[model samples]
Target: MSLAARTLELLRDEGVDRVFGNPGTTELPLLRELATTTDPSYVLALQEFSAVSAADGYARGTGRPAFVSVHAVPGVSNALIGMNNARRSRTPLVITAGQQDQRFLRDAPMLGGDLVGLAAPACLTAEEVHTGADLLPLLRRAFARVRRQPSGPAFLSIPMNLLAADEDVPVPSRIPAPDAGPSPAVEEAAAVLRSAERPAILAGDRVGATRSVAELTALAEALGATVYPQPQYEYVNADSEHPLTAPSPHFTGTEIAKALAGHDVLLVAGAAIRPHVWTPERPIPDGVRVVQLDDDPAEIGRSYDVEVGLAGSVGATLAALTALLPGREADRERGARIAETLLRERTTWRDRARAGVDAGGPLDPASAAQAVADAVAPGTVVVEEAPTTGPALRRALVQRDAGDYHNSSGNGGLGWGAGAAVGLALAHPDRPVVGFLGDGSAMFGVQGLWTAARLGAPVTYVVVDNGGYRAVSDALPPGFEGTRLGGVDWAGLARSLGLHGTAVEHGSEIGPTLAAAQRSGEPSLVVVRIRGGAS
Candidate 1:
């Protein structure tokens, strides 16, 4: 079998059910091989950025490493931002980019340049394959490194000629298997929790995605422990309204550390607890016991030396702890009271945000976001890349119980959002999928609108058009000048992409516009035009 076939075989062996990518001439050989194989699904994205994000989201949702294929130079460069986002979010992805044959690489053959250079600054680690035989080992190393440590994206490039070439190269030998599960340290963490006077559980992405909220909730309730959802990466628990929740302190940095330190013990579940999330000015109070449990080891003890570090499946660890922790009525009563308070707080906040928000003019970005969120049934899927307005949008679209809320992650790779919406829409057609994008983000993958339109996807897009790359410009740090990205015409672009499109400048036009798009039967776009700087 050709190296392309063997490489594909390897991916299949890795249990990759699908690959999300955009191809180029250099990747023709692999694409042909893909056509011959039916085990791994191939998802065509409009751009490399979208392809990478699709892979990222796929990994995040399915809890397995996903593959991404893209061309060298131009394509890889376009995909860099999304890769960066994946790295930031620590989403596992194995990315393959096409490279010109090594013979002409130094001479700058067409579409040939420094791929490693372009990718290294953006991805976790990137390398090139020198020979067909080099692939098996490199693939093994790359995949393992990305999965084992930090768990982000790793890149492996193949020369176009070699991928299509025949050689004395035998199919490469298989490598070591990947290991994932909770560890022996669970007993130690439970011991700490059991002995503590006041304990808290910090929930991160793993806890949320692994469906470990029940265990976490149980542990918290059994000990009267406070449960705080770490706002970044992953979120746990159904909602702040759910019973058996103890609201964590709103303060981060020094205050968070102080609060955590003051406690007799703190159990960090699914949280990286990296320096960025904690305070350095004041250490966690003296004598505080900090225990950590996570699926990935790299995140365990990243900030402070962990008293107990357990590496295992989040679900397994939570199950063990829940089984061991006997219920205490005093703790249970405290937890119920906290849950009630949080529910009240959440209700008050939602009511204020939802009040007449439907009647706001020119469609206030926050108000519009709230309206769309309210209209959707729970359990509806959302694909949103509405940058600049993300913080406000997140608040207004408070994800309550039911459905999944997906964004571009922390990567902020603009173009990936629309295409990811497409993948998610295809992944779960039974649930309605809605994508919200700022004009700038929409520009990145609007090509996807046409693809979705053609597929007859039930995907609806809410375009917040303010005429510019609002986030990019404002995100520039102090003293940075000449911040201008010109502008993008979102409505025109959407229509051009073969999706039924409309621009609504007035608030009165929003509900009807969204309602029509949602029921359009085919993929459609609704662009809400706003005055500049509305992000």
Candidate 2:
């Protein structure tokens, strides 16, 4: 069998039924082979950035390693931004790039740069396959690493000549999943939780990635602890409507320290202690003791000092801690107090949001987000990239279920939402997918709309067209120039790209417009125009 055929067979064995890519000349051999294969379908993207972002979304949605293929040097370089996003999001992906024929290496042939070197910084494992015999083995290793703990993208550069060559290689029967049992530290962690007067759990993306929401809830209930998600990636960590759940505070260390001031013990699980984009002058609160549990030891105390760092599977560790803790019945009074506090905080936030919505004129981001949230179906998946209006959206549209919400990683890339929504719709064909994007963010990878329309994906794109980079304008000091973007007809652009388009200038039209797009059951876009002056 050809090396390409063997590689496809291994992918099939690993249950990868789709490949996302934008092919170039060096990728012809593999593309040709994929054209004839029936089991694993090929999903074509117009650009390499969309290709990688699509795979990232698919992996995050399905809890499996996604497969992606791209051309040589330029393709790898174009894919770096999305790959870095995947690494920061900890999405499992196996990204393979085609390299030029090995025979012409000394000649410095076209598209013959160091693919591994280019990919190494963004990948968990980066290597080049030199021969047909090495292809399957390298793929196996890549798949294994991508699916391992603290999962991220892996890279394999296969030369075009190698793919065209015929060599027999042994395909492994099965690759075992990584598992870490309970450790002794789990008991110590439980003791701290049991002794604390007020305890809190700061959850992260890994909790949802591992499908441990129930375990986390059980642990939280046992300890009568309040639960908060990591600030930047606030989705699927816990049920938003749960009595013990609290909205994730701002990412600034000083803000977080203030939010968590009253809590005596902070148990961080499946997330870093602190991931901040901008530094603050004030330090974290000094009184609280932090205990961290993660599958990756490197993440335990990387950001802040911790009292105890437990390295193990988050699900297993939580299960062990729950078993060691006393019954929830013993903490009934504490649970009641926590519930009352959470309700008060939630009420205050909602009142403030309502006031903001009422103060704005005809079209406002908060009102539009509420309308979209109301229009979407029960099982709809939401991908968000509207940074300036994201807080209002989150506050108005509460997500109660796991795997229902997705956002950009800590890297905060602009074009991630459109491509991710496309990939998500492809992954979950039975459910509707909606992308809430800023006008500036949508322009980053607008070509993804073409792919969605071509595939007839069940996706509704809602662009909050507040002119241009509103987030930038809001962040910079007054009198700062260069952030203004004049009117752009995003709906007309979508219509030209073969998607049904609707434009709305009033809050009342937002829900009906979205409802119409959802009823059409085709790729559609709703352009919502709002005031673009200060955030």
Candidate 3:
């Protein structure tokens, strides 16, 4: 069989049903083979960045590794930004780039460069298949590395001549991921939690990735502990409305220290102990014990000092800890007090949002977000990258499901949401997928709209057109300049890209526009023009 045929067979055996890519001359051999194969459908993007971002979202939505193919050096370089985003998000991806024919190596042909070197930094593993015989082995290794615990993107460079050559290569069987059993440190961590007067659980995106929300919730309730998400990677660890579940505190060190002031024990589960994007120089409260749990040993106590660091599966460790700890009834009083505080905070935020809605003139972000949240059907998936309006949207929408929300702020990467929505919509075809993007972010990967339209993806792209990079503007010191982004008609651009486009200037139009777009059963964009100033 040809190497391309064997590659497809191996991918199919590994449960890859689709391949996302933007093809070039070197990829023609693989593309020809893919056209004849029916199992793994080819989903094309106009650009390599969109291709990688789409795969990233698909992996996140499905809890499975995704495959992507691209042209050689330039293509891999173009996709590096998305690859970095995937690395930060810990999304598993198998990225393959087609290299120039091996025979032209001495000449260093056009479009021929060092593909492996370009992709290595952005991936967990990067290698090249030097011969047809090496292709299957390299692919097997790539798949294994990408699916390991603390999984990330892997890259493989396949020469075009090798892919086209006939070879009697044996199809490699898929390798199962290794699991780490419970360790003694788990018991020590449980002991710390049980003995502390006030314990708190800090969950992260890994909790959702591991499907360990139920176990984490059980452990938290067992200790009568308050649950907070890592500030940058907030999602539903417990039910969002649960009394013990609190919104993630601010990212600053001072704010986090304040929130954790009284907690005697901090059980950091399925997350790094201290992964801060930007933090003030404030120490955590003295005498506060930190116990960390993670599947990756490298991340245990990586950022902050820890009393107990356990390396094992998050779900299994939480289950064991819950079994060892006392029931929620044991600390009912402490739990009640924590619950009351969280309830008051939530109430205050909601009241403030209601006032904003009632006093609206030009559409405020909070009001616009609330309208969309109210209009979308239950179980709708939101892919958000609206940095300036994130807090407002989080307060207004208040997503409760563990899988209903995905944000691109993990790596602070713009332009991810547009393409991610395309892949997420494909992953969950039955549910509506909304891409809430800032106007500045929308411009970064606007080409993805063409792919959405081509695939007829069910996405309602809401471009929050604030006329500038509001997040950057808001962060700058008093009178800094050069952030203004004026005179771009996002709705018109969407229309030109073959999507249904609507321009909305008032909060009243947000709901109707979103509803109509969803009902249209095709790719659509709503350009929401807000009061244009620094956030």
Candidate 4:
């Protein structure tokens, strides 16, 4: 078998079923080989960045590494944006590129500059295989590294000579190694949790993945505690309005201190206790008991100190806690109070966010979000990265089912939105995937829009443009009066990338625009210009 063909088979044996990519001349050899391989299917994208980003999303959703094939130097450069996104998000992805023939070592071939250099700073590991014999080991190491705790993207460069060479290398069937870890600390933490009067638990992306909610709910109820899901962790399916969910009154130093100070014991399950969270405006209470749980050792108490730190599978930890605590009457009573409070607060917050929107200016971001909400059928997936307007978007969205929310939780990167939308659409093509990205973030890895257009994907891009980097506006930079840094011709930008784009300037225009896109069943976009400034 050809080296390239056998390598693709090895990847497929590793449970990587898809390669999302964009082809270039340097990558042509691997592309042709990938095309012939039966195990892993190849999906084409219009840009290298989108290809990498899509692979990131596919990996995040499926809990398996995805492959991306790009050209040697230029393709690696373009894919760097996504490589960074995947690294930040801790998504397991293996990006492969075709290098110039090995014979061009002394003299620089057109696309043969240092490939490892381009992918190094952006990904977890970047390696260039010198011979066909090195492919299996390098590939194995890349897979192992990317799947390790604090998992991330990795890269490898395949020279043309190796791709075409006849090498007798042992290609073993890939069996994914188990990543299970000890959870003894979880039991000890539960012991601490049982006796506390006022306890709180925070859920993150990991919790949303497995048994986070049920276990946390049990523990919170038992302790008569409050629960908080960090938006930074991508909504833990714990709504801001849920009684079980605590208020993040402010992210500022003063505000966070006031918010977290009341709890006597705080358990961070699958969520990070960022320094800003515990000691925001004020130093956290000196003796508050803190327990941190995560599968990755590197992430344990990173931003905040933990009295007890547990490293193991998140679900395993939660399950162990459930067994130890069993159940408690005080927990149930406190849980009831939390539910009642959550209902009241959720309604109030939703009303407050919606109040100004259904009334003011040329268009309201809330009502505009609401329009998209109405236009979307249930079961559709939403990949949200609209940080500033996150509260409004969450309030607007009606779907609360598990996995309906696509999280870029660990890394709040901008380029993740557009390309991630492409990946979700590819993974679940039957469902309509909407990307709620702000304009500033849109520019980060927007080449995905071109990919969507080329695929005629059923995903829609609903850009909330308040002009400039709205996230950077803490209330005007130095000179500007309002929030806008500048104007972005959203529709013009989309059209330039080959997507069917439209401009929606008023609240009334949202419904029609969304309806048309849904009806067309094409990759379309609606750029809604709304007044900037926090709601």
Off by over 4 Å in 2: 273-275, 281-284, 328-330, 351-362, 532-535
Worst 10 residues of 3 by lDDT: 272-281
Tens digit of per-residue lDDT, candidate 1, span 1-535: 7778777777877768787888798898889998987678688777788787767766765667788999988889888888888887677888989898878777888999878888887777899888777877787677767666467889988898878876555544545645666577777777877887767777766776666766676667777777766643333343544554434433346655654664778788886543333345644556778888887777777767679988888878877876777877776776666667766765675576566454534555666666666655445677777755554455545454223767653444567677777766766767777887777777767667766776677788888766565545555663343533345566676678778778776665677777777766568788776544523
Cα error of candidate 2 at position 203, Å: 1.5
RMSD of 3: 1.9
In Å, residue 266's CA in model 4 sits off its true spot by: 0.8
What is the number of residue pairs that collide in model 1? 10
Give residue 513's lDDT in candidate 2 (0 to 100). Answer: 81
Error of 2 at 25 (Å): 0.8
Q: Which pairs clash in the backbone of model 1?
A: 85-411, 181-312, 181-313, 182-312, 182-313, 205-234, 253-279, 261-285, 379-402, 379-403
Which stretches in model 1 have alpha-carbon errors above 4 Å? 34-42, 121-125, 140-149, 168-179, 195-198, 234-240, 244-264, 273-289, 363-366, 392-403, 412-414, 444-451, 465-489, 504-516, 528-535
Measured by lDDT, the strongest candidate is 3
lDDT of 3 by residue, 469-490 (tens): 7767877864555787868988
Q: What is the C-alpha lDDT of each candidate?
A: 0.70, 0.82, 0.83, 0.73
Q: Which lDDT tens digits does candidate 2 get at residues 115-206?
A: 99999999898999987878888899888887787788999999999998877777876678767776569877877788888888888777
Instruction: Tell me each candidate's TM-score.
Output: 0.83, 0.95, 0.95, 0.89
Candidate 4 Cα deviation (angstroms), residue 82: 1.9
lDDT of 1 at 533: 54
lDDT-superior candidate, 3 or 4: 3
Error of 3 at 496 (Å): 1.1
Off by over 4 Å in 4: 35-39, 179-182, 235-242, 247-255, 273-285, 364-367, 398-402, 409-412, 475-487, 492-498, 533-535
Candidates ranked, most accurate by lDDT first: 3, 2, 4, 1
